[model samples]
Target: MEFKKFKLIKQMQSTIKKEFIFLLFAAVITSSCRKIFNLPKEKEYLSNNVNFANKILEPVLGRTNLIGGFNGDNSTQPIHFEIVNARYGDGRPVTDIFQKAQTYVWTAAYTGTEKSLAEIEAKRHLEEHPLFEIRSSGEFIMWPSATNDLVTPRPADSTNYPQDTRFFDVKITNTGGERLIRDFQIRPWRERPYDPADDMNLYTGGPAPFPETPYNVLSRNYIRPSRMDNVVGDSTDIDLGNDNYHRNNVLVYIRPFTGGNGHSLRFKVLNKDSVAIDPALFNETEWVRLVHGFNLVKTKEYVQYDVAYPIPLVNLSTIYAPGGSNAYIELKYSRTGFGQQRVTTVLGLNFGIYRAGDWEIVFHFRKDNPRFKDE
Candidate 1:
């Protein structure tokens, strides 16, 4: 018993040292750890031949307005901001989804110390668009005049334009002087919607041939192409275990104003049309987030899930999205500060349309209510 007690004391001492080391590292990491936004850390991962998501889904300049009018009266409401109008890089407006636009632009030219020709033109364009015609009371007009409608977005190639949107003074300013300033990134598949499977399926030779190149297919190894345990002619099928291969999982892409923050995003699967799936089809409750909280690393980024995602083998393609369809999911995000202070449930966002409730899952082209908090 004495020997056992001595061993236990030694083990406890060792454990205490490990715990202390872990806490010290975690604290230092919290402040200086950089985000993983710059992709493909090693030169080996980036290939001229391969097409990565970062290449295709770069952030595009867009518009956002407070959902309802910006109410400054502190007695009436808490200072809230949201995004209303969304547009694409190619000058296509996302009216079907959010369906509202802010009438005003940043007034007073953004005079940078040293400017390029592109910068001069972009700022000139921005100055032309004013937040409100009236200086005293400025609210976004739902019905924009023909003059405002003619105002076009900045040229896509212009560098560092729209970086600062503090053109107008808010009617109600908080202690931090926080306004509706934000970065609006357009979601992928604005015009053309394709299934995840389509992105994964291998591209076989077709029109225009290999020289022209139609390579968008994923690896077929997960389908179990190899024979079982080297049994020469055995018919038994076997799956070579791969713990967390992304190709066989679900991919969720998200964005944020800041990077390198810890947050958790909870989500549940639904039908393609943004409607709840039936019990026979799927249970949104089974899809509810459990003990395995899907934590967000380095703020907003594409997250891939493995066994956590369902794979119904009986019908094969029944549980997930069908070949031609897309999978719809509801998302709710929550984050705390460095000292574990509870931030607002709706952090720095109001999808620019809904005024009363909070929404974080306004992704996809569907126009239905996100119902992010209800579920």
Candidate 2:
């Protein structure tokens, strides 16, 4: 028995020596890995990135663009998409005038003469114009590029549109039981550029600062279409007219309020909760007074103007076909901020998709009206 006890002690000593040696070796290897090989310790979570901020700062929330996606709200504004204004090709004045991102939605109609640009015609009004509705906030699973394996169209669901290079596909699960897959585009909004007419109007004498220098400030403002809301049956609906004899494709007018001494362009709210769906109600009643291409100031009392302008060549799809569903045309204006970003939502005027001409949906506010009022 005594001999057995002594043997047990010896065994314990041997085990202790082996464990101590192993621990010492492990310590040496771990310390050397960072210095000699620049490797993290075995227990450390491994990541390929040298800079760690990007990993921790993921899913950083920002403002959503028109197409129901997150917009690149950073400055040194890198523009990823193109709008076909005559002013687009000209160089933009880049400046950091805005500290945060901002968005503007300019609703325009192409007059018969102005529809010559190929860029305007290339997009089939509804198919090419992507619409998305984010009903709720959820995790956005991001895919790096359009052609990535993640974007492979589902085999069962054959309804597919050509990929928009401008956006990346990310999906979410809302509080409701619906799953939303949206294309999130990241783009920087630029400052409103100076027009040659501005020389005649804005500055008769100020030396036109070259685009990259002082005159052109990189604008953080952007405007986009609104998210598609399955719940809001009447939201994002714009009216089109039916004047068969005179096929005026798109019509926008600001006629003086008829039969009333006082002129008011007051707006009414229509949504999922409205009493009854209003018919395509654009006529002399829905005239939009525009203050052409003016920047808006945000305050408790917002400002707008009213004026008459020529309408543009209209390209609207047949929305009210027998089996078709009424699509929404909500425009979302976003203002990025250090804290919560400011957002303004504009619902499209509901109109009959089948026949539209003379039928005018009133845009509540005008972009270029000469007269101004605060409300």
Candidate 3:
């Protein structure tokens, strides 16, 4: 009985020792893992406030063309920008402007959600009560370019047009949304001399100093067709007098309110002829072709004007006769004047589709009287 009791006590002691060894091993592993995961936070050289203030100082005080800045309000001004190879640290290479890096702009307000920078710029204007946060990865800095001709318009009558010049103030803001205003002067870089009698170049004389005009100025107009519809009969028939044949063509006339030159006029054809004749003939035919170029009528002589005067030609596809398809016309013209002026212009049209046996003709303004001005 004494020997059996001694053996039982030995077994209990061995079991306790095994459990204590296992517990110690687990504690060591847990402590080591905690130390491995605890990393130190990264430090930033520039604070948000310092970065925000710098954008305003460099442009005005330093007289630097390139300055880092941001827009507070979602105005036409761009937002979120970065400059490259800019001066940093104690001693860095001071190179020419070519040393600069590509810059990027971000909206002042952003959500924690992931999104692209372009998506942010587009939505920034529409967002209400948006919050933005900005940070640089030490890769680049943001700066503005030299204030030159940021926007320009082509001369209306290149041969006779006097140079159009305008001086406007540019308003800039920083990350904190503080604004900085700078005056920018712009004038037409005329390639030729001006002649008032020459209808071809009415707006261009030579490079002139900026004139007095508001910076944010904009202009618009409403055009009305003098006559909606007219009819023509057989080829031999002269006037047709609105009877036997159908006239599907309409005329639109435009008049401007503001008197400056170097503005563009755009026309959008919203609706088209719905008459259905034949598909095969319509496909082969060039339905929309410039019969006669746009003409400006003056008291002395009528001048033929090419569409490529103010802006580059934006070519549109021809419309087909099965008649459910729609097309549009966008015409851009620039004008320069000393004061308010009125000029009459005409667009010749041929809207009817001809197939051997059947003819399709229809006319209605889908969206008429819409005009925009380039300021």
The residue ranges of model 1 lying beyond 4 angstroms of the native Cα positions read 1-79, 90-93, 99-176, 190-375
Question: All candidates' TM-scores?
Answer: 0.20, 0.17, 0.16
What is residue 369's positional error in candidate 3, in angstroms? 36
Return the number of clashes found in candidate 2. 40
TM-score order of candidates, top first: 1, 2, 3
- Residue 357, model 3, lDDT: 16
Query: Mind giving the per-residue lDDT tens digits that candidate 1 earns over 112-156?
Result: 221233343344222233322222233342222111233333232
Taking every candidate in turn, the Cα RMSD to the unseen true structure, in Å, is 25.7, 24.1, 22.8
lDDT of 2 by residue, 1-375 (tens): 999999999999999999999999998888877799887544422122211111111111121222223333221222222211111112332122112222212245433222223433343232211122222222232211111122222222232223311333333222222223233333222111111111111121223333334445432111111221111112222221222113222212222334322212212222222221121221112122221112222222222222111111122333211122232323222232225643232234222212111122233222211111111
- In order, the Cα lDDT scores of the candidates are 0.27, 0.26, 0.27
Clashes of 3: 31
* TM-score leader: 1
Worst 10 residues of 1 by lDDT: 225-234
**How big is the positional error of residue 174 in model 2, measured in Å on the Cα after superposition?**
38
lDDT of 3 by residue, 1-375 (tens): 999999999999999999999999988887776688874433322222322323222121111122234323333223333333323123243223223322223345333222332443453332221011123321112122211122222344443222233322233333435343332222323222111111122133322222232132332111223232222212332222232112323323222223212221222232223222121211221222221123322111111122211111111233221122212222222222225443112222222111111111122232222111211
Residue-level lDDT for 192 in candidate 1: 10
Q: What is the lDDT of residue 195 in candidate 2?
A: 14
